[model samples]
Target: MAGRKKRAGNPSPGPSGGPGAPSPTLLVRGGWILSMAPGGFQGHGDILVREGRIQEIGPDLPRPPGASLLDASGAAVLPGLVQAHLHLCQTLFRGLAEEMELLPWLQTRILPLEAAHDEKSIAASARLALTELLLSGTTAVQTMETVHHTQVVLEVLEEAGVTAVTGGCLIDQGEGTPPSMILPAGRALEAQLSLAREWNGKRSGRVEAALCPRFALSCSEGLLRECAAASREKGLRLHTHAAENKEEIRKVREITGLSDIAFLDGAGILGPATSLAHCVHVSPEDRARLRDRGVHVVTCPSANLKLASGIAPAAEYLDQGINLALGADGAPCNNRLDPWRETRLLSLLQKVLAGPAALPPGKALETATLGGARALGREKEIGALEKGKRADMVVVDLEAPWLGPGGSPETRLVFAAGPAEVRHLVLGGKTVVRDGKFLLWDPAEAAARAREELKKLLSRAKLPS
Candidate 1:
């Protein structure tokens, strides 16, 4: 539901495989291509992939010799869903903290568990998160991890072959913070710089670094300003939380004489390079400033409802021309990282809040796909199923009960589809998942490892079994 770009409707030379050998080619045949481009959906479409970029997209493209073929006759081929905001490090803490509000939930359960994490547990958590995301048809994500052992999460992401922009959560202040979780501004900045040096632009630019200041209450004004400056200096994006809870807003106002968005604006952080998550309580002034500054707002509907945080004015945001994307905040709060659930909830809640014409199906789909890419600053590379884009997409099987033969595919996808409908996934021209099964690693084994690591983590944290 945003800007549309013309399709590059031609073949281009692919990345070099070696000195003389040809790059791998894959032909995805006979799917309903939801290009998400200007032309919209195309029936009986064939997508040709070469050297990890989309080489051609049209009907009845002749398959070259020695190319692998994937049949998608009864599927909907579209860009892989992008989750603009997530916490992969907190995936292992699913349901460990329940029925609590934002601040107390963080102080009592999440922060302590995050502080208790060792490298092994953190690695296991990242693996689990990656597995869930891939199986659920999410190919790209922007995630935030806790203060220490952040590199461990990046290592897992790099090995897993998922597209991601991740950062270490910077926490320097705030009452009720664990001593282990607190990091002085200098030390936190040093660690973030180290991570950027090591992991930024890795995996052929599929994974990158972000500057993540935890939130207003957790970081001082000086640290936030430094984060803003560092992001500009390094050409990185800033990720953080803002205006999620009433108590948090009160605390921010008490600390600074302005609201959360106003303080960030004063600190030179409200702009195109920044993405603010869970902006459920932003005022009209805040929204106007966000729209003016071209800042992206990420909505996590399930987490907001679960934490009893207020719903965001998504329709109003769209009307004011502010960019918005959907996210599953974290496993502890969301209990799952499924983008389809987020998409459906994003539309339903908005319609409930502001009449039936609020967020339509196509717009919701756009927010989950292109809007997410725009938030991550990858709108030109990913998001749309057009020629000359990266070959990252998901195939959804429509031969299911919920998605019957009634409405358009977009309507069915937004209002009816779920994880069980995702049949195959292609990332960078590679078949990572086929027939709802991951080709890289066994998800069951990943879950088992996460359980074992959780036991160790809780034991180390002196928590109940």
Candidate 2:
């Protein structure tokens, strides 16, 4: 992806030419590089990026001819943040479905609103979410879209130039499910297969497809089994929610005579290729199943807390050798797509749940970066500033007075830094955000489009605007 041209007399460093032009080689010089790799953190280092991959990382590297130079003095350079679970389709519904648990939040407001989405609304929602994510230094995600018009979301993701693993929500049966959102098991599987054929490996393998079954309650046993089989056969990732709330867990046990995790396991859905979200209420047996099966767990601390769900045993999960990652969830639930907020919340919540030493700043930052990459099976390609990895990084201006100079870089990043401090975001060797402003498009225009689309969506859903 080529970057927008730098305007005349603008000191901000960016790609040299207009969009669609060849991606310029970039040399990032003189930054405190926190590589997130083993013994990789260094002060006053330079990174060489060419052909969308990191070529070298050391102090005082020679700048290649005609390469764009990003002066990173007094900044902290780190790998781009990765969000393991998100719902970009819900970006336009922020603050619209408050004071509700998971089931009600879905039945009353979220489902109907999602059911009302048209192509235009979906596009608007995607653009708005991508704008917030990119500005917040999130360069990769594992997101799920609503059932219909998922192609529109994939198209928007392509245009935004982010690595993603996404697919439509698969719901074959559930109470209060919108009629339009429901599909037969065969139809849903076929639809996902079709989506994979079209979108998987697109953008040089930046955008891939996953099998998302919504949750155990929303999907049938047959649908879950078929998804598991298909995922194993096709080498696709399986994503879903499990054991998130007490009420939801009770309902699942009462209906299926098993816990949510047990049900999914019986359906052949527990494996390394599967990523389960919100394992807040897992039993010992369930935890064993997850760890034994090598299933990745994504803990959305803000969403679980806001919906009155219990805090997850994140520190315990790490202790048990279960791969753990972080996410902000959807907009209506968390109200923000910022990974920094999630990282901070995860650390504090773990401290409260365990002890002050539980999940320290360095480990918490690793969960947000390396853990997320492992969850998406892209650890070799991203999550570090190593040679031959994709050039996905964020330059954070650490000169802010609020981030007192006493703490370590990891401490400041996990506790003090935020989106405002993210000076530049580079994805695939392209500088999409520079000097705290997006160079691809105007965020104001994206917000304006979301506002108009939200109005139309409310009208269609017959809900109060």
lDDT (10s digit) by residue, model 1, range 1-465: 001111133122233211122238888888888887667556778999998889998899999987767667777889999999999989989999999999999988898899899999999999999898988889889999999888888888777666788899998997878898788898998898888987776556788888899999999888998898998888888999999999999989988989999999999888899999989998888899999999999999999999999899888898899889999999999898999999999999999899999999989998999989999999888888887888888988775766877788888888888787887788888777666667678889999999999999998878544
Candidates' C-alpha lDDT: 0.86, 0.89
Q: List TM-scores for all candidates, in order.
A: 0.94, 0.96
Candidate 1 vs. true structure, TM-score: 0.94
Q: Considering every candidate listed, which one attains the maximal TM-score?
A: 2
Cα deviation at 434, candidate 2, in Å, is 0.6
Q: Please give the lDDT score for candidate 2.
A: 0.89
Q: Model 1 segments beyond 4 Å from truth?
A: 1-23
Give lDDT: candidate 2, residue 2: 12
**In model 2, how large is the Cα lDDT of residue 204?**
68
